[model samples]
Target: MTELDLATKAPESDAQEDSSVDSPTQSSPIMGDHEHCVTDRPAPAGQGPTGEIIKLNDIDVYISKPADYPHAPTRLLLFLTGGTGIKSVNNQIQADKYAAEGFLVLMPDMFGGETAPGGKEAYVADNSVSLLEQVKLKAVEIAKSFLIDMWLARVTEAKIMPILHKVIEAAHEEYSDAIKHGEGIYAVGYCVGGRYVLLLAKGTQEGGNDEESGMMKAGPFIKAGALAHAASVTPDDFKNLQAPLSLVCVENDALFTDEVRKVGEDLMTQDNVEHEVQVYPGVPHGFAVAGQYQESNIMDAQVTAYEQMLRWLKDH
Candidate 1:
């Protein structure tokens, strides 16, 4: 892990919360609404992408294709959202931008159309606490009660693997004539989504080597992956990863600290896995998807990180 050593500033305390903790639930039609599940036009700009919503194995996946798509995309991107789950405004913006650049982007609702009971308002209810305090509390609650105990339990490999298979099947069906035979399918994820990327790359639904046995596998389709400000990932998690990986770390991120970065790098190197770790200065966690509220430096960092991902995808 070579360090670039770019000048950095302390992260500012912006009012915004990481999407992983506090995002509004999207109003997209749920599964079984066959007619409304797929649409040609997306929601308003800044809200969602200008693409169609398709149901994959009963999951409502928002798919944004290039305007001239079916001409075959250079690559297919499975863009996973942060803790805020799918339908995060920032995630939508990122997906739309990538689609405009000719990549087919798919965003699945990680929460299966469910959201925090009170949504964004729940985070702000206790005015006695600072915004940061609220975010921290909400993050812990979601991680323990929802993410680990509920969501992941229901959306296991049995459910998710088929969705991945179906999405790829649909892509091939639509662009059969134009697809380049050896072109790749790539994945990029932020925060909790990043953790999922690693799981997919390793062909298992859960982390750790022992737990992977008999898990429904789905890694073969993914050629490469990039993780940005990932959470809950341990060095051991990378030992069995099959695809080349890129780690986009933020200098001031509380979750992805220097120690965690080193552990990941050391493990990847020892395992002889191809990997790259780049640290962006002056940014907080979730900068890749939600840096719009930060200063110019943070915004610039966000663009630079995104460009790095594009380059990595092209090179790999």
Candidate 2:
């Protein structure tokens, strides 16, 4: 089969809430590692919004419930955001798209309110600049993750695990009727968010081994997951898979590096993991979230990635 139709083994938005309940975001945990919700009854999807924030662990969780939800239990998915954190327009837009496709999409802010400064401006690629200049910018941003109190340090495993658990609990509580199929959840992540899904894909095994793949159980965590232009993750994160995975990557991402991307590919193709990896050759790291922009509109690369993401969600 083609790379797009791979049978290789591998592993692992937002809108607003219009509810009366006051809700809002932060959940972090370590990598085998760091840790990582949903709601309301909404009608069919639309261009406007198929999502809303509801209170889960006292934080606002952006969610979109498909009209035919719970029909396929795996339709429930947890959406982990990248350095952009949550509540951004890009995230909300993606969440709506997922919900529109019949998936129950949930996203909680992983960085609390301390998201990386600058939004899309900080990430837009400038074709005129030297590649070295672009690489330097990425290096500076990654280095900040190590210093105490930067975005990554603040959302360490210990800090975010509780909230991540509560997110699942909240999902169970919200979709009480369809409890049987609800446990086996799916997850999708963008950028650093993909790191979190791999951690969950690490499964419940303490040594982080998926020897029996028991962790892919009808889980309160995840049954399967997908990653798009992922960043800030390591080989230790993606090598072993407890479940199925769909990875959508880009050509020039420093964070998702050639080394790391190769490991993911080998795991799916060489190793025994069940996975699918798609690399968008000319796009930047955040293409899934409309990272490349034109005047007042996002470029078509975002659309292409969007179609890929939804297809992975459906097939997997």
Candidate 3:
């Protein structure tokens, strides 16, 4: 079905609670050691003193690129951070995992800073605001508020798209492309980053034009996107997605639950699109983050996820 036709589906009850009833910090241990696969790497490619900056709305946007490699794959993992933002403790671990797997990683700071206000205390805060206020202002707003969507437009504006355009352009400008396909880019996004990746796959630079055109014309910068524990974009937004897509939902993920599943399911029926949904048993939200640094089913899930993504990227 056409995307416009697909977009007409009514939005769901924003009233549904996505928070985990059972705490992840309190989960009992499982068999295998799942500590972070990556250690000693810098936090993402930027967020440091001397990383490259791409200015979007004059907001000193940071874009991290892995150091020069003779045989770098064309794939790019554009990470979108969760509540903790880009400097999150989980990022280093995931970046290391993707880099080790041979994908050139780019962790973009969608949020201006790291960590959200009130921390996890909001979960148990009783003297706090009403449930609707808590969910709207804190939960949904923190993830994909109206402003963030507005920011997407700015990224696509004449001045901003060029910056992001240059970032992707420069990557291919210097890579070998000897592995997998000669010229194809793949993406994996976690949490907020997961939703960001779909926006990326649908098209780029907010309006779904400029950056996508430039990147695609530049040398096949993106072919497919995979979202893990994505809680940002609603199913209605799935209409924007065009490239091959994969949705990963953790059994213990507090963010994107069964309601999120219905959205992904609806998108699966679209033509010329390859979509798959995988729910990892007992895995938590930010499972990739946890898997990279601790013991859990996380690593297996990530490996399986990436393998599926690569297979799709190559075939599509």
Candidate 4:
């Protein structure tokens, strides 16, 4: 199949863990979008997570603090997950990496407990299935959750933003003094998670979407935000951006298409917000985290996106 074949379906966020290993993979699924190509195979191993999952107001948060720095972190970062949610050990591992760099990272479980059915796999260079064969596979898998799109649709800014606000409010309060010494709060999101990062940038000083969306105005959380391969972004989402943003886009994506991306960037420019947009050619959606499970080229691009995103948060 062609390189883009894997992402031709729904947003590819169905990554699963090697359940046989002793980890949180066996736990019940929760909230998140299926915006990445997923497979049944166990993904690449990350350095074992150094932080424990702590329950905070019904949300399971993976908190990682700086190593030797006793003062505030370099930045208090809220790591919004891809569709994989906190179930993605890789997301936790990524957070730990940020913590090692002297950033306090908070990765919360937005997915209460709900994983996607898996029949497809990552976009590995080794896969040689014919187009016909892959299509047939997707058809059968679609039967598993014909409402997959509807299910994904439920994770809207209105529905999930409050949960995010709760997470940030509680984490910020807990890390009060140390956070004050830091560079304030920043965020990075992957896949559908990217959409929320943008919303965080656009949110009110009370935090979350407009009160017209029926959410109570919560405390402010995000200072700046970054996202990669964002999915489900509407032009209206960009109309009132309030924070700095960095976007690492891929060349090909069905959801975060060029037109939509242009609209968002143009709006950001019109709003005179601090932002940066770069599209890495030849990669598809979900390359930031999901690509690490694919071919070496994909993985390399993913690594570059990581470094650029980190720099954006620290220096911006």
For all predictions, the C-alpha RMSD in Å is 9.8, 11.4, 9.6, 8.1
lDDT of each: 0.57, 0.55, 0.45, 0.63
Ten-residue stretch with the least lDDT total in model 2: 29-38
Model 2: C-alpha RMSD to truth?
11.4
Model 1 / residue 298 / CA error / Å:
1.2
Cand. 2 TM to true fold: 0.67
- Using lDDT as the yardstick, the better of models 1 and 3 is 1
> Considering every candidate listed, which one attains the maximal TM-score?
4
lDDT of 1 by residue, 105-163 (tens): 88877556753222233333234555566566655444434333343345343444455
Best-to-worst order by lDDT is 4, 1, 2, 3
Give the runs in model 1 whose Cα sits over 4 Å from its true position: 2-48, 116-119, 122-182, 203-218
Output the better candidate (2/4) by TM-score. 4
After superposition, the stretches of candidate 3 with alpha carbons farther than 4 Å from their true spots are 1-68, 71-74, 118-166, 169-182, 203-221, 252-254, 290-316
lDDT over C-alpha atoms for residue 46 of model 1: 50
Q: What is the lDDT of residue 210 in candidate 2?
A: 28
Model 3 over residues 134-224: C-alpha lDDT tens digits? 3343443334334333443332223423434544455454333522343555666655456556655664334324544355422224577
List the candidates' TM-scores in order: 0.69, 0.67, 0.56, 0.78
Per-residue lDDT, model 1, residue 23, is 26
